[model samples]
Target: MAIKFTPIPTTTAESWRNGGTDAHGQKPERRISDGRAPCRHCLKNVPEGDAVLLGAYKPFDAAGAFTETGPIFICEKPCKRFQGGTNEVPPVIAQRDQFLIRGYSADEKIDYRTGQIAKVSDLVSQAEKIFALEDVSFIHVRSAAYSCFTTRIDRAR
Candidate 1:
């Protein structure tokens, strides 16, 4: 099966750059990259000298146990959104040592026993295995240490 890696939605990203409030409806903190920040749109590291907006992100609509705010870094300047392709891991994630991947059900609820902290080398196989499960609606990639939102994954159409 093919896989799709999705970044934060473009509109949401634009809001952050346009000086609009974040998902929490508060102005995001403007900051420079420590060079570790993964700009969701480009799915690449924002260079050390690049600008970014650090703010809270909840990757879902309905507020519930599964829905909670966490930090995410976005480009301070507008850029194209990532359109995930098959057989490729974005550089931002590929360069990392480990990541947290979790499965969600059709209703967008977390699927039990479906989360794993995977090594970068194992991400592809791990994501493939998760997608093989029929009950999993989608998957989310996050920082294993900080659990910060990174990106979303789905079966590629």
Candidate 2:
């Protein structure tokens, strides 16, 4: 199956910034009322009655100095799909508040140190430096506040 990424909504971003946590612990998965749907990563509300599931995921990998993968509920429903093409990163990502874009090498080590981007246009140039790494498979765009995975870029097929 092809890899796909969905944009996180703005409202969810606000909630996470304000302070929220998954009340339920690991193992015993929890389900919330459809009316209260929220994206585990961005902490934004999923539209009323949207289907959501609580599952574990590692935003980072296991056994690393910064391995940060964890449980998150992605939209079980289709919203918008993003594929890295045309060398353009979406405006939503470029304009996000307090974001850090980092490129990882094939060994998953952070390539050029991550930097803060004030606008979306900066991503293309910033990404160019890391894109050349031989083992780089993906780029992680994340929120600095929670260090949450906002989106990932993969080789376009």
Candidate 3:
């Protein structure tokens, strides 16, 4: 199955400019390094010999008063989209890490419905269950620890 990874929205730049803070007003700045950190998209730590750029990204579409976005880097080398299913949920997802997965209702509202997957391994099963719901349109996987978004998955129409 081919899954298209959505590009981080431009609004994230503003969020970054505002100090890379989330809705909770917590600021999580990138490590100040002469070098670069890993690109979350490609799951690769940036090599010290390569170049990196500071950019803002909104993992989600802007629609509310408290929407969040942040700063990230664009790798010189393009990264491939993640194609793995449950098997590739990532080890980080399951290590007692607090995360949030929101499932949208049909009306495009918050749905007041959300799932908390403590670990990465639980994400796939939780996502599968959420996707199975007829009313859910998509899901926003976020890190509750830092309130940063990991990724968004739109149900296949």
The lDDT leader among the candidates is: 1
For model 1, the stretches where C-alpha displacement exceeds 4 angstroms are none
- With a 3 Å backbone cut-off (N, CA, C), the pairs that clash in candidate 2 are 12-44, 57-70, 58-69, 58-70, 59-69, 60-69, 94-120, 106-135
- Return the top candidate by TM-score: 1
Candidates in order, TM-scores: namely 0.95, 0.54, 0.57
Ranking by lDDT: 1, 3, 2
Local accuracy by lDDT, each model: 0.87, 0.51, 0.52
Give the Å shift of residue 157 in candidate 1.
Answer: 0.3
Best of the two (1, 3) by lDDT: 1
**What is the C-alpha lDDT profile of model 2 across 1-157, one tens digit per residue?**
1322334443333333333333233432345436544454333555566655554445544468655664455444444434334565554454454467776765677765554542455555555555565566667767655566666655445
Model 3 TM-score? 0.57
Candidate structures ordered by TM-score, highest first: 1, 3, 2
Q: List candidate 2 segments past 4 Å from native.
A: 1-45, 59-62, 78-81, 88-95, 115-118, 132-137, 155-157
- Scored against the true structure, residue 129 in model 1 reaches a CA lDDT of 93
